[model samples]
Target: MTEGVPATAGSTRSTSEKTAIFWLLAGVLIPLMNIVGRYRVRGLENVPEAGPFVVAPNHYSNVDPIVIGIGLWKSGRMPRYFAKASLFRIPIVGAILRKAEQIPVERSGNPRDGAGPLRQAQQIAAAGHAVVIYPEGSLTRDPDGWPMRGKYGAVRTALDAGIPLIPAASWGAHLIMPQSTNRLSLFPRKSVDIVFGEPVDLSEFANRPRDSRVLAEATLKLMTAITALVEGLRNEAAPTQRWNPTEHGQTEIGRFNDKR
Candidate 1:
């Protein structure tokens, strides 16, 4: 873990063994997914050996975060996700997620529960944990399935926390598990690929406030880098299917655009 950040607010849980078990499961799961789908990763060397860093990846499917999280776990880092608070209500599932130390992001548009996701991420990074952020705040729905506009939370976190930002991209997950449904399919033999780019530095804003546009600009550039990575992985290939946003519980904009 990196130094200089404070401890988590109320985490009394022990993550050491859980992390170990998670890695063990991810090891088999990731490789199995790869072998079954014939996927491979390129640019795994881009992640730091140790970190107080943020991982920004393009989001296209619900499985995107799990894939990226497992990938990072296999690479020797504990991935802490900043997920919506609503997910914390599911019975046994919520308990597991809580023990995993995933940060809860209250999306009621309230700013009173301490810092927003960005601020929470900064605190986590400052404490030496690796954070994953989807700048778009949700999944993509482009006819071609490219990354869409991203929110400013990621930029704010990276700037305020003063950590390296790594751009990551994932391909074929949308097909493996469609964003519109909760079921996995076995039809397509496509391989999922995750590409991590070299860290983007923003040392110039080390001491800046969490509200600067510079943070948003930095996030935009990071998003662009992730998009480029995804584009490369796709090799200009077309999506196997065009999912309807309504089927996935998304709004006019949120349902169709690339999230995270």
Candidate 2:
């Protein structure tokens, strides 16, 4: 565990695991995010006063995590990401992530073999920290940019750890670093917004057997909350039906254009 700065006055609980590395990274990235875009946030009060909670945001650009982290920093909680293990293998970036105590997620291999990451996520929340997760696992391929079907890991971690699930959504980050390529556009600043919705009520799923049906229901609830926030940011209604990438034959791992 790493510790950095205390939580804001609104939080009864101070952030204990925010490390100096976290602060350094935030000090650099938050301004960078602002340099590339306007950082507009809302509903920070919706974040629990003190405890472990999950920040489930839709993935759209490579910059999403950085933007989300900036928002959480303003809200008084240091944000931790469930980054892919391969990313932790990078020389400098990996070392920084390790120092910051980010959790590494294994996205490949057998489904049953993925328990270690989820277990680690549970442990983090159980320790009173927030983990930023992209519920769709990667950037959305939903033609119109609405949240797509999500994996159940976020809900599972929250339920198992008895923490609240905070649905976060972002829109303008995609414009800063477009989803179609590994490129950056910083000349004309974009407007990026990340909103945190009220904790999703998973009371019904509490203490119940985590069957597939229950997990599916819980996943949809998170997606719904995130979609609502996204719509509010984008000022457009989400498609009534959530997009399923596999059904639509879009690759879940790489760049996918809606018009493609």
Tens-digit lDDT track of model 1 for 1-260: 11333234333323453465466656666775664365566677887665467788988787788778766865677788987687889886677667776788776545454266566677777667778988776677555567766666665676666566788988888787887766666665767888888776565555566564866666667766777787788787434343445565554332334332
The reply for model 2, stretches above 4 Å from the true place, is: 1-12, 15-17, 254-260
**lDDT, candidate 2, 161-228, per-residue tens:** 76678898888888888877778788798888889887888887886899989999989988999999
RMSD of each: 6.3, 4.9
On TM-score, the leading prediction is 2
The stretch of ten residues in a row with the least summed lDDT in candidate 2 is: 1-10
Question: Per-candidate TM vs. native?
Answer: 0.77, 0.90
User: In lDDT terms, how accurate is model 2?
Assistant: 0.79
RMSD of 1: 6.3
